[model samples]
Target: MPPGITTFAADAPTLSAANTGFMLICSALVMVMTPALAFFYGGMVRVKSTLNMLMMSFISLGIVTILWVLYGFSLAFGTDIGSFIGWSSDFAGLSGIGVTQLWDGYTIPVYVFAVFQLMFAVLTPALISGALADRVKFTSWALFITLWVTVVYFPVAHWVWGAGGWLYELGVIDFAGGTAVHINAGAAALGVILVIGKRVGFKKDPMRPHSLPLVMLGAGLLWFGWFGFNAGSWLGNDDGVGAVMFVNTQVATAAAMLAWLGYEKLRHGSFTTLGAASGAVAGLVAITPSGGAVSPLGAIAVGAIAGVLCAMAVGLKYRFGYDDSLDVVGVHLVGGVAGSLLVGLFATGGVQSDAKGLFYGGGLEQLGKQAVGVFAVLAYSLVVSAVLALILDKTIGMRVEEDDEVSGIDQVEHAETAYDFSGAGGGLSTRSTPPGPGTSPAPTNKKVDA
Candidate 1:
C-alpha cells in the first residue's frame, strides 16, 4: 500500500490473482499485434520491399519497450500535470515499487498495467510504418519512432486515459484506444508521409501485395488477439463490462468484414482476400474505442459503416496522389474517426458508464465530447509528427536515394532479400542484379493479389 494511492482503507484493494493473470495474457496478446501487423503489412508490399515492411513494425517492439520501462509509462499513467502530461516519482524507471503493489486502485499489480499499456505504445508507432514502407531509411525511421513516441504518443496517451487527464476528467469515453492508438497513428502516418513525399514511381509502377495468404494469416491473428485487447481494457471481468466489450468486439468486426466485402464486390466487381483482411481490421479499429460502451447491435452498425467508409477511403490515396504504400490512413484513420464519433450515437448509458448515446436518447452532448477528443488527438499527432518528420528529413534524410528504392529497399538498406533465388535460376525476376531507377520491369504474370 503506497501512501498516495488513497484507496479507502477498510475496503482496500487486494491483488486479484484472476485479473493479474488475465491482464498478463492480454498484454501478451496486444504485444503479438506488432508482429501481426508486420505480417499484415509485409504481405501487402511488393516482394522486393517485404522485409523492410516487416522490420518497420518489428523494430517498434524493441524501441518502445526500453523507453516505456524508463519513463514512457510514467508520462502516460502517472499523476496528471496541468491536464496535459503526467509524472510520478516511483513510475520513473519503474523504480521504488513493491512487487505486490496494485496499480492505483486496481486489483492488478502496477507492473501488470504498465506492461499492458507498454504493448499499446509499441504497436502504435509500428502502425505508421506501413505508410512509409519501402522508401524510408531504417535508421531514420527508428530514430523517428524514438522521438515520435516521446513527443507525440506519450502525451496523447496521458490526455486520453491517464487519471485526471483532461479527456478522462471531461468524460470523452474512449474505452480502449479509438482516438489514442488508431487515430493517433493514422494522423501521424499522414504527417510523416507528407514530409517524406510519395514513393518513387508511385502510380506508374503496378505495386501489389506479395502474398495475400500471409495478409490473411496476420489479420486472423490480429482478430484473435483483439478480443484480449478490447475486453482486457476493463482490467477485470468481474463486473461484466469487459464481457460486453468482448461481445461487441466480435459483432462489430464480423459486420465490418461483411460490409467491406460487399462494397468491394459492388464497386470493384469481385470480393478479395485483401478486402476481407482490410475490412476485418476496419471493424477492429472502429470498435476499439467504443466496444465497452455500445450494444452488440450498435456494434454491428458501427462496423458496417466503418467498413464501407474505409473501403472507399483507400481509393482516396490514389485520387489525392499520396503514396500510402499500405492503406494505414484509410483503415486506421477513417475507421478510428468513425468509431470514436459513433460512440456518441451508440453508447448505452447502462453499459460502461451512465452516459447514453444519441440513438439511446442521450442527445448531442456526448457527441460533442467525443468530437473534442477526436480532433484534439488528430490535430496534435498530425502537426507534431509532421514537424518531427520534417526535422529528421532535413537533418539525417528520411528516405533512401531514389535509385535504392527502385532497386529494392531490402537489398539496399538491409543487405537481404525476402527470398533467396540464387539456386533457383533467379526465380521470378530476370536480371541477377536488381533493376535500377527507370529500368524496365521484368516479365511476369500479373498476379495482383490485393
Candidate 2:
C-alpha cells in the first residue's frame, strides 16, 4: 500500500514487505545490543559500580530514542545539502511517516527504516561512556550525549548513508557503519579519556572484572544482534544479502577468533574466554566496514588482522598510561581503523565503482580517499569530544567524589544495588541514595595523641 512497494511488485525486488519485515526484526535485534553492552561493560567493572554502568547504556536507549525522533533522523537521512549533511523536511517529529508511507526505494514502511536506524544512533555514543566510566557526573553525561549525538554522529551518518552525501556520492562502500559508528565512537572515546583524566588509583589497583559470565552473555547478544546489523544493510533479501554478508560475517569472525586465541596462547599461556569474545567482537567490527565490498578471502584477512591489532592495542593504555578503563580505544578505535583501511585495499568488484582497493589494481586513489575519510572523522571527533569533556568537567565536573566511588556508584548514583544476596532492606528502597552517603561509615575522629 505504501508508495514504493509498487515499484518492486512486478519483479519482487528484494526490498519487498518480507524484506522490510526482516529488517524490522533486525532493527529490534540491534536494539537489544545496548542492553547487551550494558551487561558487557557491567561485568567488566567492579561490582560496586555495576548498576551505574548499566544505567549509562539504559539512559542512551531512552535519550537517543527521543533525540532521534525529534531531529536526528532528519539530519542523518533527509535530503542532503552540499553533500555533508541532510536538510530537514518530513521527519521532524516524524511528521509524514505512517503505515502507508514507504521509505525511498524500500518496501517496508518508513517507520521501520527509521526505527532500525535509530538503534545504531543510540548505541554508537553509548560505546564511548565506557572510557569515562566511574568518572563522569550522570547529569553532565546526559547533556554530553545530547550534544555529541547532534554534532558528530548526525553528520557522519548523513555523509555515509544520505543520497547526496559525499561518501555515498564518492562511491565509498560502508555496508554498515564502520566509519560512522565504530571509528567515530572509538575516536570520541579517546578524546573523553584524555580530558577526563585517569580514574583514581589506576595503576595502583588490580581492577579486574567482577564477573566473567555476564561478559560472555553480553558477547553472545552482540553476536546475535549483529546479524541484523551487517545483514540488514542490504535492505533486501537477495542472495547477495543472504550469502555474501552471511559468509563474510562467519569467516571473518572465525579467522579473528583463531587469531586472538593464537596470540593469547603464545603470550599468556592460556586462551581465555575473554580473548575469544574480544576476538569475535573485533572480527565483527572489522567485517562491518568491508563486508559488503570484499571477498571472503578479504574478510578473513581483515578480521584476523583486527583481532591481532585489537589484542595488541588493549595493552597500550597500560604502556602509555591513558587509563581507557575498558579498552574502548584499544578495541573500537584500533579495530575500526583496521577495518576501514583494509576495505580500501581489499574491496572487490561491484561494491563501489570508483573505490576498489589496491588488490584489484584500483591504485592508491581509493585507498587515499579512505585514509582521508578516516582521518577527517578521527580529528573532528577527537577535538570535539575533548572540548565537550573539558566543558563538562569545568562547568559541572566529571569525576564522582572519591568516597562515593570507593563505596560504589550503583548505590551512590542510582540508589539500586545490582545484587541483593543479603535480603537486606536496602534492596527495597524506592528512592536512590544521594551519591557519597554514609557507606563505609564515617571515619572516627579519634586520633592517637603523640
Model 1 whole-model lDDT (C-alpha atoms): 0.90
Task: List TM-score per model, in order.
Answer: 0.93, 0.89
- Residue pairs in collision within model 1: none
Q: Which stretches of candidate 2 lie over 4 Å from their true place?
A: 1-15, 350-355, 424-450
**Which ranges of candidate 1 are over 4 A from the true structure?**
1-6, 424-450
Q: Whose TM-score is greatest here? A: 1
Candidate 2, residues 1-450: lDDT per residue as tens digits? 011222445654333667777888889889999999999888888887788888888899989999999999999888778988885678978987766676776656778888889999999998997887776778888888999999999998888778787876766666778888888999999998888888877999778888889999998898888888888877666546445876898889889988998999998999998898889889988898788888889989998999999999999998998989888888888888888888878988665234578998888877777777677778888999889889888988877888787677777788887877435663333324443765554333442211
| TM-score of model 1 vs. true structure | 0.93
- Find the candidate with the highest lDDT and give its number: 1
List RMSD in Å for every model shown.
5.5, 6.8
Where's the lowest-lDDT run of ten residues in candidate 1? 1-10
Tens digit per residue, CA lDDT, model 1, 1-450: 011245788878889999999999999999889899999999999988999999999999999999998999989888889999999889999996789988866789999888889999999999999999889999999999999999999998988888878887788988889999999999999999888999877988788898999999999999988987899998876889999999999999999999999999999999999999999999999999989888899999999999999999999998998888899999999999999999999999988888889998999999999999999999999999999999999999999999888888999888988976545566464566778999887676554322
